[model samples]
Target: MSIPFGHQQLHNRYCFEGKLELVTALRISSGRASDETDAPFIRAFDGAPYIPGSSLRGAIRSEVERVLASMGKEVGLISCTLFEKDACAEKARKFLQKIETEKVKKDAGSNKQKNELTAEFAKLELCDVCKLLGSTVYASRLVIEDALPVDVAIARNHIRIRDGVGIDRDTGSAKDGAKFDYEVIDPINSSITFLFKMTAENVTDDSDRKLINLILGLLKHGLHVGGKRTGGLGKIKLKETDNAFYKVSGFENSTSLWKAIVNGEKIHNSIEWQEVIKC
Candidate 1:
């Protein structure tokens, strides 16, 4: 992943590694049913329910957008929800066209210089949220790994059933033949904990760093994932103890960062590497 700004190669890596406890039942579905049930929870190939990285990324992106839409508006942190027609990116393209036209007229700058200028302008056009969580125009700054139960045996035993019925709005009654049941894990209360790890690249900007800290704060305070959020399922929080954010900076090139990434080394807690920072 790049720094959510441009497609430049990443030279640095920062990792947030920890355990996340399931405070409530989770019911993210596989969208297919087994012979014994109308719905089933999503599971890894090992037959244990695992939360996909894509799902976690989507949820965090939504939360980041929500925060940016509220806190970033005053500072020009635009939120473009439009698909491919995001206005800011479009405007940037148009502006780049003008710059290209002017450059051609002046016969100024080498091809490399022109390309660098275009990239800078494009980067400037991105909003803070787009710069942090990413949009259609750019790749995200970080990646999350799929969350799996630390103790698979415990997870296997936690599957539970929940019955749901569709209601008719007009009659305020249960719709005929609309009752269904689905599978959930550790529905009421849970002792289930999953591994949580996120890796971000080339986050040097203060605003980008602050956004990263804010995301951690949100996770620390807790956030709900999976389905049935309105019904209070999928409430998860970072385990405060032993959680760590590693700012593995001071590297000179991508080679060292790649080595650090592969090793998954946990550095000591110091003035630099704090455990969990407030937003």
Candidate 2:
């Protein structure tokens, strides 16, 4: 099948041509809002109540759009046929329409006029990618992508992928980490020109290809979190003093990449990072 339009072409000849990176740093604490049914109806739905996958996918795509925009390229909402005739899309359409209508009614102060609105029509439409990929890559703790350098390397058996890094939220210690939790990264199709922003520094390197590569290398390898747990409730500890340094690292790359693109130029990678000292 021919590649679709309004989407960045994946698997290109140049690293910077079709390849780019965007890192996102999530404010984990900000995610704890409850009683969101009182929030704007557009914001509340009956999905997992966890972070929405579409929100993350939208984030990645938005970053890609920003990078393309900087290059004087124009792209728009990547409308997908994946949702056109499918049951999920139809369901999503009906669901959104109902909620939007209800929102209007609620805003008009329509109280207690009970209509036969089923609970099924209020769920959020998750990103189809998550269903296709079979895990929550969209809502995972982190997502990082690197445009592969043009020269492809050949190796026997499976090539070793690099480890990404994470920092302890409590103590100011840096630890090697995976870009995502298990069942998340496994099904990603590298042939596609999309990757999750791993750490914040990757989005705007100061044209320091070497430094960027060095940092990516350090991150590409798995960083360890000192704990013995599995799944979403994993644990780690760092001294309080160093917390801010790592927090900065998380934002240096993803959404901030667009901020750097102000005045029609990409921001230089000039931020200084210092290792956090343990208390």
Candidate 3:
């Protein structure tokens, strides 16, 4: 099948390695518990506090959507409930249908055909967010790894309980039996790191890259994560330590991609890709 998107004809994948510092206590609650603390932070298999990739992805996507909306651009995939009423949603649905129809015709009982269909789907003409983060019709080009604490021992020391109470509107005071406690990651003593990867297939344009960079810029400005934002929780600052951008069309081996990242060469200055910070 032919590519239905714009000028781009090859895949361009970019990888970002970064660290997240908690400026304030972050409380990504795992929900209520029977223990002393009513809420607790989410933990990994090893019983250590961790930030899920999905959480980060959702946060970034939401912020980018807001930015796009401010520019009078509708990039987010809207819900079906609003499809008929929203112009953006209608456009997205039509685009998805076109890809789905073509994919069905090209679908054969072979891995090659499946891969080709996936590639074609990724190249569809859709909103920037849907193109990068994906929607129902396309697979996500962006992959975010779980952010693990750099030092587990140090991370443990940062965990603390914060007490809270609900207030009665009429009395303007704490409501009776409304006291609660939740666990939080204290920023005073800890920091975490994570990895980000983006695969831009058949990208002949710079709009998506510019948008991704804008999202990263927003992330650096302290994006709130988790819950209780009104109560001053989950404020974080993300810093990118290393990044690599590659044109993967003519590569002889896939292992070279990892090698480029490992080499740590500063290639963010290139015009072909967006400029990313090194520190």
Candidate number achieving the greatest lDDT relative to the actual structure: 1
Each model's TM-score? Answer: 0.73, 0.21, 0.66
Q: Residue 112 error for model 2, in Å?
A: 25
Clashes of 1: 0
TM-score, structure 2 vs. true: 0.21
User: For model 2, what is the alpha-carbon lDDT of residue 164?
Assistant: 30
lDDT of 3 by residue, 212-264 (tens): 66666776787877777657777767664555222222221235445556787
Give the lDDT of residue 262 in candidate 3: 78
lDDT of 1 by residue, 106-180 (tens): 988687766566557657777666666664435677778999988888877898878878677899999998877
Which parts of model 1 are misplaced by more than 4 Å? 1-5, 73-122, 166-174, 187-189, 243-271, 274-279
Which residue segments of model 3 deviate by more than 4 Å?
1-10, 32-34, 72-84, 87-125, 166-176, 189-204, 240-273, 276-279
RMSD of each: 6.2, 21.4, 7.4
Top of the candidates by TM-score: 1
- For lDDT, candidate 1 versus 2, the one ahead is 1
lDDT of 2 by residue, 1-279 (tens): 221211122211112112221122111112232342111111123211122334433444333333323431222112223435644456556655765687787774232322213211221243322221112211221233332222222111111222234556777577555242211111122321122233321221121222223323323321111111223221111112233212232224324545545645444443444332111
- The clash number for model 2 is 24
